[model samples]
Target: MFKTFVASALLISCASAISSFDSYKKSQKSNFTQEKSQFSDYKKAQQKAFSSYIKELEKYWKKPIMTSKKKLVSYAKDKKSRTIIDFGHNRLTIETLAKETQEAEQKLSLALVQAVTFNTEDFYNNDEFEQQLAKIEASHKIATPKIDAEPVLAPIFFKEQPTKKSLYHFVKHNITPEKIQIQKSSKIKTDKVYTLTISLPKDATIKRSFIYYEDVKREATRQQIPLALVFAIIHSESSFNPMARSYVPAYGLMQIVPRTAGIDAYYHLYKKKRLVGSSYLYNSKNNIKMGSAYLHVLYYKYLHHIKNPTSRLYCTIAAYNTGAGNVARAFVGTNDTYRAAQMINRLTPEEVYTRLLKDLRYSEAKRYLMKVRKRMKLYKKIYES
Candidate 1:
């Protein structure tokens, strides 16, 4: 009976694999046929749509400015003699004005469709579709297995003085050593042990800190991220300076670029459009809120496959400094083009950390990761203590 059951399971698995492969082949054939059939018509449609849209936009812009005098004169005249100023300054009946507006709006809708469908071939050229297909194939190649819990990182020890040994340990473990403090031994005896402290910059102290503690804590809690991690990021980015601005023109404590990460987080979290000419990021509360929200997106959205909390935090921190694309590149090997999340799912936490440290392209990004990690430890020690 046992042999029969095992044999039946093996046959089922084989059938499923074969079915999946056939489905993939059918999808490929369909995509190819659709592309070939639509190629010429797609270009012609795009050109026609854009030309119509431009004509409508010109009409909209050239709409006549109806002066008060003209309105009064028109109103005084009989319906047959009276003429409303239509678009392009042409005198016409009110019905014509309404008709033109409706036509223009319709043309605008067609233009949008053209814009979206323009250069459909370019989409396939990027190989993203192929990569996604590959990922799906890989997923089906194996059955789902139980996931093991990640191992906890050991506590880091900071000595009284900065030594080569301590520095080496910090680098090996990917910790940032921001500040070192040496304390005199309190003991009167000739042989006494002294305490060495690893601290953040003086600007990070509460007295000089620009971030509102309550707001950061609240936002971090809302995002389900650690408060220490938020604090450390702000410390590394701007050293808690609310007015800080980076060379990239990233503003406020978290140094967010208003157009990129800021807008992305704003739309994702608030479910609203970010308007132009807004300077909300300069406000400490708003900056921390947006920055924290962006970090949340990076961790849970982009690096979601990294199961270990520590590994995810590290990759998210790196992504914050650099772009998420760069972080993904580090994971799949610099030379490889696999999607970051898909590749990350196949590796251990330690492997992810090691690859990030060694394979990241930019030296600055590598340093940024180290600094953020180091500051995180310091902030955790000070605030959580």
Candidate 2:
């Protein structure tokens, strides 16, 4: 009887052990199935979220044209606002930026296509799924308004108008002062004023000489200022360097500054007299012509105010150096160099004019006048001879 009891106990223990192993295996299988279902749900959720975002963007893209004047204005403002960023801050160059913008547009278009193609039913099974499907269909059904419907392009939505500031910035960017030859003389005339002549190479070719001579002559004649004065001003400004620029962002041979020659002034001048290729301020001949005209105007103003032709020229040059207002104050004060210098010291933007004049080195206005006159006489003799 005792032996029978021991065998029965062993059998009961074995059965318990087998039952526990089966239970554990069943539990593991259940857990694995649950985890797989959860993973699938999570993946579907992720795809749905991405699809919703893309679909919403497409809705905007295909939205009916309800263009109000105000909306267009705002769009234009936003576009222009981006223009500053477009030019200034990107790691890449302008060409690269343009490429990037195109790529972004393409991405947006592709996103819309992907959103449309993605299975919406896989994301949801009930009312939510129906609502999303309806919304997507509605968005897709929305018609794209014609881009060319307007008789004239809206001002705000159109290409940005080039400002004087932009032109100035472009000029400064392109011209490097050090590379420019500010006062290169021609073989024909060794004067400060550059004369129109053939730019003969070290090995002269007649064809090249003729081509260069005609080009120079054409440029001179088109500018309305005497070729000699044009040369003189360029020599004074940038020494005949095509690539010449100034420390203060003055560009080209004539050193035209943005403040003086930008769009509003350019347009105003154009209304008064036609201009070519947007601006003459960058063109060597044009710059000299404009400067000469301005100098003549200053001379007239000085003669009216100061009553001396010779003194007027000096005052006008000084005025050009600083401004007419500063020069006026300088003249009205002591009329003596010491007093004029002392007076100029009191004005604003004084440093540039003072430094330039001091470097030129005249103790008095009379001497300054004499120097310019003497230079002008010498320039005429050299060029005319």
Candidate 3:
């Protein structure tokens, strides 16, 4: 009886496979005939649809919606179709074509398994649902599965819209380092205030420092950090000193600590080289660039927790004076701005405010800010003159 049942199951499975194959072949013939009719109908329907849309557009040519209509017209023209198909409004035609084609191919492919099954009994007596279950396994057998051609992911080709990397390349290429150095130096000199008290060497490229300053300032602007804050930091750190130094041996116009910030970063910080000394710190452009970059770093670090610009600026300044780690520590167990303020007050100014004098550290950071403002006025008066 078991042997008889197995034979019956095999006969039933074979019958089902034959029925499915016949149905699929019939579907293929139907689809082929329908495809020809559909394309013909599509051409007729497309003409009618496009004409109707163009008529509607002609009626509302000057309306606000006309902009979108114009785009539709341009796209239709690009498609170069005789039919007035409103493909933009109803994409069903193309979608239907894709759907029908995929279904036909899938069905035809599924029906073709019997030829292979006869040779290899591996697929014999497989249930219809079971065969579907093994579709992934069956897919591996296909030597060269159909792969529809796709456009390569190349960069957009627009005569008007140049590539971003190309733009960067063109900019770097067209403008020689020599030209950049000269132009940057010139811009700096024009913007910088020259003081007779500090005699600059005839051999120095003072303008290069200014170039670095401008680049730093532009970067700060792009980041949306208040220009006032950057200028204030420079004022407080070195009095816009370009050549300012401190007793602790903090160097550069920005008064950057070499050991902490690393010797390698100094090149990027100043954008120029100098003999190792405190006087190099006094260069106005280098000071501003490093000072701004440091400020930007602090701004980013505390940006998530703090929302208020004024408060964030204070914490950033505190972080600048005291290490960010200490400032972060001070915020432990409290998100209260006032509490953070108290912690900042308790932290020793000496650890952070290496460049600030006694008078500047007095009124929580307000006095420091006041000094920066005062020095900024002095810088403006000297430069603007």
Candidate 4:
């Protein structure tokens, strides 16, 4: 009777564990599906406050679109350049131009401070309808039009942040009404606008953007990801744009996709799958933690079997931008990663690097790999310092 009771208790415990695990898996899948279904709303949230700023305002013509209003500001930063453009309602006189120049300096300072501080909560907000909509969805009322708060900020990338001037001088340019070409807008046009442009060189931009080093080093070391690589990827991905958002809808300093990279990294750190929100990703500390974890997943899990560390690093860089499947195909002409590892193993790291530069599936991926590697080398001193 004693042995039978013990056996019965063991079976009950096993059944309970199995039931709990099944419930966990089911919940994770449900969360993923629901998050994916709301992609449209979540994506729209990428644009900061929609409250009349974007809807009612007229914008200018540029490679990326911007709503040009009175004293509008925009920033473009990459590995080699930093650009800040501001629009004014009237064509500036010499005095006004000087004022605008000072303002331009202020705008650059603001951008850097935002990068340095990662204080971008104002940018990733949702409207009343979005909030209620989220609730309704949680309650499975998909068809109901729920009330959401009206959004009032600009898009995260398009949104301006805080700071003043850097040490380097800006190559300043001014554009009068005739020189400027804006996008045609249905909204009442504010006539006679002028523009101020400030262009900062690569080094100056790097110095300004490379803040939050202590946090980055801490997170990278904790995740066992290379500190230089973390810094390089951040510089290359956002050019240290704390509030940067790509059309891929990747968010924050590291440009992590909410579902894919973000979820994986969150799971790696906490053992729970979670979709990171844009505001959450905008925080530099949170962004680096997720970014470093994803890189660890890439190098240690997805690309682990490759024989050479140097060769593996190259593949990891390529995979980070493109993917493991593409990296595999680049080497062995197959998408089977383990099979490609055999081919990569036979080559020296130098050989793998050269071949990747030559044979990657997309020019953009190849360029991305190059940019990250170059920036990584550039960050080595920063890391050491």
TM-score versus the correct structure, for each prediction:
0.46, 0.31, 0.31, 0.69
After superposition on all CA atoms, how large is the RMSD of candidate 2?
A: 34.8
| Residue 172 lDDT (model 2) | 47
- lDDT for each candidate structure: 0.52, 0.36, 0.38, 0.59
Shift of residue 81 alpha carbon in model 1, Å? 71
For model 4, residues 1-385, the per-residue Cα lDDT tens digits are 9999999999999999999999989988897678666654654543443343334232322222332211112323221112232211212111111123345344444443333233333222222322332443344323222222211122222223322332121112223334332233322243222233333332543453445577788888887877889887876776665555665667667888876887789899999765656556656777888899999998999989997988998899898888899999998888899998988889999999999999999998899888888878877866566
* Each model's total of backbone clashes: 2, 8, 15, 19
lDDT of candidate model 4 versus the reference: 0.59
Whichever of 1 and 4 has more TM-score, that candidate is 4
Give the local distance difference test score of model 3. Answer: 0.38
Q: Report the C-alpha displacement of residue 141, candidate 3, in angstroms.
A: 66
Report the poorest 10 consecutive residues by lDDT, candidate 2: 80-89
lDDT of 3 by residue, 1-385 (tens): 9999999999999999999999987986686465445434533453454455555544323221211210111112221111111211321011001123334222222222221111111211222211231342233221112211111111111123345555555334423323211111111232211100111232222222232445455746755566555554554554322333343446544567644432323434554322222222333344455556667666664433455555555557655665445444445533344455554455454422332233232344445544654554554443334
Tens-digit lDDT string for candidate 1 (2-47) = 9999999999999999999899879866854554344334334434
Candidate 2 has a TM-score of: 0.31
Pairwise TM-score winner, candidates 1 and 3: 1
Residue 274, model 1: lDDT of 49
lDDT of 2 by residue, 1-385 (tens): 9989999998998898899989977876676456445434533553575466445433322221111111110011111111000101111111001123334233323222222122212111212322343343334332112111111111111134435555445334423333222223222232221111111122221121221233334544653334444444444444333323343445444455544433223333343322222122334344544555555555553324444344444556555445555554543432344345443445443443454355433344434433444445655665556
lDDT of prediction 2: 0.36
lDDT of 2 at 330: 43
